[model samples]
Target: QQQVKQSPQSLIVQKGGISIINCAYENTAFDYFPWYQQFPGKGPALLIAIRPDVSEKKEGRFTISFNKSAKQFSLHIMDSQPGDSATYFCAASYSTSGSRLTFGEGTQLTVNP
Candidate 1:
């Protein structure tokens, strides 16, 4: 069973701080790992991602650290801000799925000003 689970459904951090979230998966069939950021009322946009073959990937202020042996992954946000407040979803799927995504429940991040 390929399932992805996330922790800390919500997070509160002051501006200029760092926010961390964790995720775990159950299946090895998943080949594509992606993190998505969603605003209040819009579709999720790709944040960062890594393949099972990679250990880490970083984009702008966002980073994804993947652990293939443990079948786990995580998202790290640096220098967080109120403007960065949003919901984040960690997802995984096979490339063969044609980008079809299986997502974690979500993490709502609140950056206090």
Candidate 2:
């Protein structure tokens, strides 16, 4: 079974709008939640991450909201811009789970100018 699941196989947003992507995990052992952004012909880069200890984490226009009890998390892009257009993925892992990560299927995002 897929440990992590994400919604909205694709998304489109206008500039300066809000783009939200949600994720849910079945493994309670997952303690680390991270979001990655990838562009064509490039590898995914870690955009933001959160630990189970925090309810939310924000960096610039990127934010991660985690719900430990619900085993869910989401990424919210505020003031979305064309530069932010990319494929976003949500991942979950634990210290004991080795270096591998359980990733969501990914959401393709398009930010229109």
Candidate 3:
């Protein structure tokens, strides 16, 4: 079973616009929610994260909106720029799992100048 599902397999946004990617998961044991951004030739890097206690978390231009009850979450990029173009993955993991994460299918984002 695909524990997590992401929508809009690809997205195109203009510079200065908002880029949004959504994800839904089936597991309720998950506590750590994180988003990762990956460039073509580099590994995915942690962008931002949130715990179930909070509904949202923001870091600079990246924000993660989470809904614990609904088992859903989303990543929003404000003032998106060409440099922000990359593949984004939403992931969840429980403490018992250590560093292992259940990831959603990545969303490919392209920001136009």
Candidate 4:
């Protein structure tokens, strides 16, 4: 129940379009959900996150929709731009477990100009 499954291994979106990525988890014990965006040769950086208490959270053009009951969540990027292209990952972990995170396989997004 510690696995996080992500889909659409790759995605291509035109500039100004919206990019969507989905993820699901099996662990109900998980209380912290965070999304990370990584560029080539760089470590993953925290983008946005949500707790089970919040059904949705948005930061600028990035939004995260979470369904605690379904054990699923998704990330949406509005008005995607070429500069936004990167590999994104969804992760889950409990705060008590230190900084260790259980991550999804990852989704590569390419925004075309």
User: Which candidate number would show the highest TM-score if scored against the true structure?
Assistant: 2
lDDT of each: 0.91, 0.95, 0.94, 0.95
Q: Which structure is stronger by TM-score: 1 or 3?
A: 3
lDDT of 1 by residue, 1-113 (tens): 53999988999999999999999999789999999999988999988888887788888888899998898999999999898899999999986778788999999999999
Candidate 4 displacement at residue 22 in angstroms? 0.5
Give the CA lDDT, 0 to 100, for residue 63 in model 4: 99
Superior by lDDT: candidate 1 or candidate 3: 3
TM-score of each: 0.93, 0.98, 0.97, 0.96
lDDT of candidate 4 over 1-113, digit per residue (tens): 44999988999999999999999999788899999999999999999999999999999999999998899999999999999999999999987788589999999999999
Give the local distance difference test score of model 2: 0.95
User: Each candidate: how many clashes?
Assistant: 0, 0, 0, 0
lDDT of model 2, residue 26: 99
Flag the better candidate by TM-score, 2 or 4.
Answer: 2
Candidate 2 per-residue lDDT, tens place, 1-113, comes to 99899988999999999999999999888889989999999999999999999999999999999998898999999999999999999999899979489999999999999
lDDT accuracy of residue 96 in candidate 3: 92
Write down the TM-score for model 3. Answer: 0.97
User: Cα lDDT of model 1 overall?
Assistant: 0.91
Q: Over the stretch 1-113, how does candidate 3's per-residue lDDT look in tens digits?
A: 99999988999999999999999999898999899999999999999999999999989988899998899999999999999999999999999988699999999999999
Where in model 2 is the C-alpha error above 4 Å?
none
Pairs clashing within candidate 1 = none
RMSD of each: 1.4, 0.6, 0.7, 1.2
